[model samples]
Target: MVRMFVNGQAMSGGSIHAPLTDARFLGRAWTAPRYRFWSFRDEFPGLEPVSTDGWSVPGELYAVSYAVLRERLLPLEPPELELAVIELADGSGSLSMRVRAEALAGAVEIRHPDGWHGHLATRQPG
Candidate 1:
């Protein structure tokens, strides 16, 4: 299983089984519209079981324009950060993500179709 140490906590997903240093663990981007979010999970079937263990969180999907995606995530990433493209499982397209060295901390703001915004934070260990 691929293990990612996000904020010192270990997160393993089926799609990632190699060491953290593996290139695969680098920036992996995935994008799905508000409609076909399930396809994202389907692409990496192996990750399903692991994804449920701790990484699973109820998150609503939003359709973000490519310009907005670049404006939000790319600018915040460090210079050394790697870029990965996560293609929406539903075949819509892909989103860009920057893999950081630090543990997965902070919250992600997702905008729903109805103009509602939700913030999701990483699961904290007890």
Candidate 2:
């Protein structure tokens, strides 16, 4: 099975998350401390690797089979998102979704505490 890291609406209790339900949840994980994060119109998060100092973005990991990866997950993903190898905190790598440069234009920078969950919290209505 190929493991993939999910950092946006495909996460638990999120929109468009059903595709991952049958996959094995590998619990929470973080990226290497060199990535930038953004919320694209509050619809989803987009992460990119940067050379400057950055914090690890928190997210979930899953073990998906090749059929699911090629046939379902990849196809269901937004056009702006692409599959790329991501460096994890555990000194390992997993296939992750990275945002293309075009998608991040005019996006809201998710600085400090790089986590989608934290960003989502700020958007909740009290």
Candidate 3:
């Protein structure tokens, strides 16, 4: 099984969390403090590597079998999101998804590393 850090709707109780149903939860994790985050219309979020400075995004880590990642998760992901190699706080590389550069051209940089969760928490019912 491979580890993936999910910081968006794939977390427990999130909208698109169905794909992780069979995956094993590995508790909470955070990224290295050198990445930026962006929100895509609040439906989901994206992460980008920033050399200068950034925050350590908080999220849930999961250990999923190779087949689940390659077949299920990847297939259900949106076009704007892509599997990315990220450096976790533990100094290891993991596969996750982030927004494409083109899609983030004018997107807002989430001020807080854990902004995604915070944003969603404050959302009102439509």
Candidate 4:
């Protein structure tokens, strides 16, 4: 099982876990969009589409949108709260990661072979 930590505190089990297997992280960067938008033209007829700029959505709506969008694009689960890139040690090899939600801000422990261990910290956002 994987253990999760947030801001240096250990979170309980059952948090979503997504392995970073794809090589997309090789050159890509995570830039929180200055604006996030969704169109409603198709869903609501006769009503003009609505657009929201900036990160000012209500807490519930924001949470729902975060969950939907993250799941649609990646393997992230709900309530994790942010994004981070991590590297884990597994036996003779290591695994690199790009995770979402509260799992973003901290270091993770990776147990190594021969009873050794390693810790990887999340990268700072620009």
Candidate 5:
């Protein structure tokens, strides 16, 4: 099983979480403070690795089979995002999604303290 980090729709209770229902959830995890979290039209979130200014993004970790990664998970990913290896807060590596460099042209960079979920909360109308 490969450790996969999911910060967007594939996360638990997220729109695309159906594919991961049978996967073993490791736990909540954070990325190393070397990524820029972005929202693509608020449709989905993406992580961009940066060398200097970056933030730790929160997400869930799961142990999934290769088949799930290639079949269930990957195919559902947006074209603007790509698969990449990222460092976790614990200094370990995991498979995560990062925004394609070219795709950041109009994406909004998220600066909320809570990262993805925080951004989502702000989007909710009360």
Candidate 6:
């Protein structure tokens, strides 16, 4: 199993969580305060590592089998995202998705202390 950090729809109760049905949820985790969070057309969250002035993004960690990672999760990812290693708040590395540099042109910066879920909360219709 490999550790995977997910900050968006792959989390619990999310639309894209089916792929992880067999994976082990490892509870909540945070990214090291060295990345910026983004939303590409409000479709998915993206992570961009920054040199300075970053914020911790809330997310979840899971122990996923190689088959799940390759055959299930990855195929659902958008073209704008690519798998990359990211540092957790505890300084541990885990595989996560980062926005491709080329895709930034269409991204909108998002600053929510609670991360993707928080952003989604605000977008709900009253």
User: What does each candidate score in C-alpha RMSD?
Assistant: 15.2, 1.4, 1.8, 18.4, 0.8, 0.8
Tell me the lDDT of model 3 at 85. Answer: 86
lDDT for model 1: 0.27
| Predictions in order: lDDT | 0.27, 0.85, 0.84, 0.21, 0.92, 0.92
Instruction: Count clashes in each candidate, considering only residues at least 3 apart in sequence or on different chains.
Output: 12, 0, 0, 6, 0, 0
Off by over 4 Å in 6: none
Report the C-alpha lDDT of model 3 over 1-126, residue by residue, as the tens digit: 989899988888888788789999999998888788888877788888888877889888999988998887888777888998899998987888977877886667776645678877666577
Q: TM-scores of the models, in the given order?
A: 0.26, 0.92, 0.90, 0.17, 0.97, 0.96
Off by over 4 Å in 2: 112-114
Candidate 3 yields a Cα-based lDDT of 0.84
Candidate 4 lDDT (Cα, whole model)?
A: 0.21
Superposed model 1: Cα runs more than 4 Å off: 1-60, 98-125
Question: How displaced is residue 82 in candidate 3, in Å?
Answer: 0.8
List, residue by residue over 1-126, the lDDT tens digit for candidate 6.
999999998999888899998899998999999999998877799999998988999999999998999999999999999999999999999999999888899687889888998997888899
Give candidate 2's whole-model lDDT: 0.85
Clashing pairs in 3: none
**Tens-place lDDT digits, model 2, residues 28-95:** 99998878888888888878989996678889999999898888777878887888998998889999
Worst 10 residues of 5 by lDDT: 111-120
Per residue, candidate 4 scores C-alpha lDDT tens digits across 19-119 of 22211222211112122212111110010112333221110001123333344323543233234322212211111122332343442322211111011
